[model samples]
Target chain A: MTASIIEDRGEGSPRNGEADGFPTATPLPVRTSEKGEEENPSSILLGTSAEDHHIARMAALALGLSVLEAAIPSPLPGVKPGLANIVTLIVLARYGWRTAAWVTLLRVLAGSLLMGSFLTPGFFLSLSGALCSLAVLAASQHLPSRWFGPVTHSIFGAFAHIAGQLLLVYFWLIPHTGLAYLVPIFAAAALLFGTVNGLVAAHYLDKNPINHKIQRHREMRPDCL
Target chain B: MLSIAHIKPGDWLTLLLGALLTAFLGVTLWQGGAADKAIIRSGGKIFSVVPLSRNQLISVPGPLGISQIAIHNLQARIASDPSPRQYCVRQGWLKQAGEVAVCLPNQVSVELSGKQKNYDSLNY
Candidate 1:
């Protein structure tokens, strides 16, 4: 796991959105996945105790947010690289699929609580997106990695995320009149923006070679190949 | 500037699929513009939120054509509508849904309810 170094905000005043009554959702630190699950080693060692669980819960908060910050719109306001997703991909690439899936659930819960959008349809929408990405990662097993470059991986995963959102909204719960249309608009948004994120991520990976620290057997594998 | 050489086939497929989905949605929403009487019981404040006549309803014109908004408060009534506003009158009346049409101090907010309409639900 990459050692996370967060800038500490003192006990003085609350963070930007914290003063609005709702406590800012604290995130958990990154941890290794065992049995393809988001297991914070600290909490596991401390036992299934409630306080440890709370600490584990806070770990995914900021990292999940970072994934979201990635997807950028071409026009800027809408353009962003799905950065937080890199975390998702990384989790999957290292720990396998289930751990990434669990991480996504945690991210959804944390993001909703932090954004004060808990239980809203929008929260569910985000969950669907994460699930969609998971689906892509799962399905990618059939294809050659050479076909899925960092950019393509991000793009396909983003498409899956958005498609999952549309599927959830249009099929299961509240059937609004024309929500079916939001799929394509958002999918377009995902693809158009997703490509840029993928490219940037690709560039980043190229620039930052892996150190001898993390023992990754798949390091020999090309992400695109 | 980024090159398209890096884009994958799946990328194009997703974009095409997304566009097709949008086209279908636009048509459905446009065709089914009218919603039936939905009575929501919220907070004990009676709300009459549905449309009186398909034609009498005040709809804001956009790319989607018209949006039906119902009024809520007495304050909203005092305010002047650029046109004769008639969302106040409707078929079924109830208030528990937390939807109210307010024509208040220089403002108009026709609370739209996300009920009964077949909006999409999360499946998998």
Candidate 2:
């Protein structure tokens, strides 16, 4: 259905082929009728749509936040507020899971590179945590949205992130049973930080509710689907 | 669009799970039983084992110097050490299984373990 709409729009708009850059390579019938306005054409030549640009911009923002977090001195090695995840929650809420996944992966990759911890144990731990949290966020989508807001998603993601890191630490790094004693402390930290992150995300979402309508429009875009 | 309203059942479920996990871990740590003996290790090797039931002070030599470990009344503590920061001495006592006091500069570590020991490794 969406393909047909894009096709119809393609036939009507002379600017579609112009935006695509490689107009002569693939010629199609062009109708003279006009209706739809021409969307941003820069993405067509770049092979990346406006939505991709948006994702990249958000990913950069998340990376900046991650670097800022790393700059802060922490007494405990593993304990962090994980504020970078706020961008993930916002992206998930506004753009859905796929965009959120892209932003998160990019943040983890680029953030680690900027911090000079790429391919190190720290990178692996961050990757594992991000992956687990993304999985949780994806799974949380099935729940009724009326009840599960950014706060709930944030909490679940935070706990899963910690649990994933702990599992890796136990099996690969330490392999000692004594690590169990610290579980309580870690869990408590997870709970506290999760709630804090959730509240921040929720507050941001509340103030910027306009993104929901814009995201809905983007979802209807054929290239996005 | 996602609702920004009161907490839902799913939120409660997560909250409940996190609370339950925290509570379980807290209880286990709080109820950590007394250890029968304390194991002293130096340079990653077992230096000595002192029974906590008997009151005694033993000195173990390591890279930095000797660290005196005192065991008495089902508790063990670092009595004295030559390390710059008497961090191990400040650790006070290890009455529960899974507790550990380490004088890292001296390469001496004291850990409590029993039949019902809770931990297999002390990370810090």
Candidate 3:
């Protein structure tokens, strides 16, 4: 994981590397001669790197939550607490939007496969909802972090997700005039669940911040030098 | 640990937005009360159209049994039903143009329709 993060820093623009407080421009030779020479054989054979493993771990966590949620019978067909969204929020806060997007897409794919809903209407709805939430999260980044946190982002994502699914249903699945009246109910549910999930994500982020972990790892690495 | 103690402007913004959305929906629901009639359906077919202006009681045959509906003072409600859940009755009253009360087990539903429809369909 450290190696992959270093590689990311090394490949990023100088300004980005500087922002991360890493001297990427001059570290390539040292990195390759030392740790890069001892690449793990399993990672090489599988064509998976530390970064892929990191994404996989997050996706797996989200998939587990999705499966768990499915086990509980819900009164409404489309309404679920959406606890899996917590992983996406954490990834977005720690790793940035691109990584969060990858994690979210992976979760949707893997989760559908696990639930045996792949290629079904359920899968399409999940895909659309995930994409919509990610788009909303991306847009919400424009808001000042000081004023916004995981909870706010979660609310936005939830509303966007429901809107996306409803639009699809209206246009393709059921074009009947009766479906629009349920929007208020669904919107209320989204607000409630979104706030809950956001608070959970915020708690997790507060306790286990990725930047602090990274900084600690960096500080401890010189002990082995 | 990174601690977040206070609600920020963004948090307030989201809360305000959510409140605004709720208010908008509430207003729409309130405005929907102008509906003139209630359209009742049984087994996916139009069972009856009762004028909201009249005070009357109507019983429609449904899957489970007869679902009784009452219309009075420009509003309609499910008075009684044989359905176990009685969800339709729990919906209370429908005065809005797009309001609906459904008894899924009995396959009975009542929807309001007015001169001007506020929404084409609701998505959930």
Candidate 4:
């Protein structure tokens, strides 16, 4: 049906081409005039992919929830799953850092627009953290081949990534004079939240949950399928 | 029964040494100039900085909400509609290098830069 519509609109593969040579398969080019603004499954599929990108970003926002921030009481502020970091990490690990960086940038742009404001500073702060996370993920991949546990690796990386955000907080956010007091609070919170996310990521890494959750999508594409 | 068999002494050492070094660095950064991060909590809400010390807190009639600010040497262009008392006004003064004053209610935030610079460039 979708192929037929695409063909009808002159946007699909071509007129002479048959998607599959089967008796019931309509030659995707059969354009009938009555199908005005009728829902095209092919276009809807493309629209769905854009929606998936939006969903991924919403997931990023969900992970960022904490304290009075997300309606759940987290003892820390600025705490997030760093899942988006993990998303960027896996993308870098499998593809390469540059592509993962682009993914991160796209996710931020999409996430911010879906969130409805590029003018706000929070989005930029998140963009900063994502950039730093990408940097850590890229550099850490080349480290010496050591007998590794995924949990420990995650802990180390997660902590480093959180620290990346801290660097921005310390060097850029706080006034020149206010560093003495802020450190204690942020440290206390980082330790608390970092351990939680580290353990969660570690557990997921151990179980390879990322494969189950996200890996299924890429396979759904026709080329992969 | 302890098993040294599971431990790659080098990897453990690296992880340990790296975490310690990072912690030390974090603590150092925290201790370096961290004293100025004053989180002002008013009526059970947190505000980054509100410059006016005397009027640290205020209540807004109806749903527009309340706000606070910390004033140091920072100039702010606030969207006055969000009752400033909401999440935006509580982020008081953005006078520090990397400190961000967030007004979530207004979807506004004032970010402090390392050096005081022209925000007009940011307009573009």
| Alpha-carbon local distance difference test for all models | 0.49, 0.76, 0.76, 0.44
Residues A1-225, model 3: lDDT tens digits: 223222232232333323332222133321223344577533322233344566677788888889999998988889999988988887777766766888889999999999899989889998999999999988996677877998899999999999888887778788865665667877888888888888887887666545555454345433211
Residues B1-124, candidate 2: write the lDDT tens digits. 3233535567777777888888998888657776899999998899988788899999999887789999988999999999998999999988888799999999999999988768543534
| Stretches of model 4 off by over 4 angstroms after superposition | A1-69, A74-76, A81-83, A89-103, A113-117, A144-146, A149-173, A184-192, A209-225, B1-15, B22-124
> lDDT by residue for model 4 over B5-82, one digit each (tens)?
433444465456655755775666543222233344433355354442233333222234443333333333233335
TM-score of each: 0.46, 0.63, 0.63, 0.42
The DockQ score of candidate 4 comes to 0.07
Q: What's the distance in Å from true for residue A87, model 1?
A: 2.5
User: DockQ for all models, in order?
Assistant: 0.11, 0.29, 0.25, 0.07
What range of 10 consecutive residues in model 3 chain B has the weakest lDDT sum?
A: B1-10
Candidate 3, residues B43-105, lDDT tens digits: the string is 999998878888999999986889999998988999999999788899898877878899999
Q: Would you list the rank order by TM-score, best first? A: 2, 3, 1, 4
Query: Relative to the unseen true structure, what is the C-alpha lDDT of residue A188 in candidate 4, on a scale of 0 to 100?
Result: 47
Each prediction's RMSD over C-alphas, in Å, is: 16.2, 9.8, 9.8, 17.7
lDDT for each residue of candidate 1 in A71-138, tens digit (9 for 90 to 100):
33345222235566665554444434554565666777776787777788878877887877878877
Sliding window of 10 residues with minimal summed lDDT for model 4 chain B:
B115-124
- Candidate 2: stretches off by over 4 Å: A1-46, A211-215, A218-225, B1-13, B29-113, B116-124
Cα lDDT tens digits for candidate 4, A147-194: 543333344555565566667766766534343344455544444444
**How close to the true structure is residue A196 of candidate 1, measured as C-alpha lDDT?**
66
lDDT of 2 by residue, A12-85 (tens): 33344343322222454443333222553332332333444566778888888888898888767888999888
Evaluate model 1: give its lDDT: 0.49
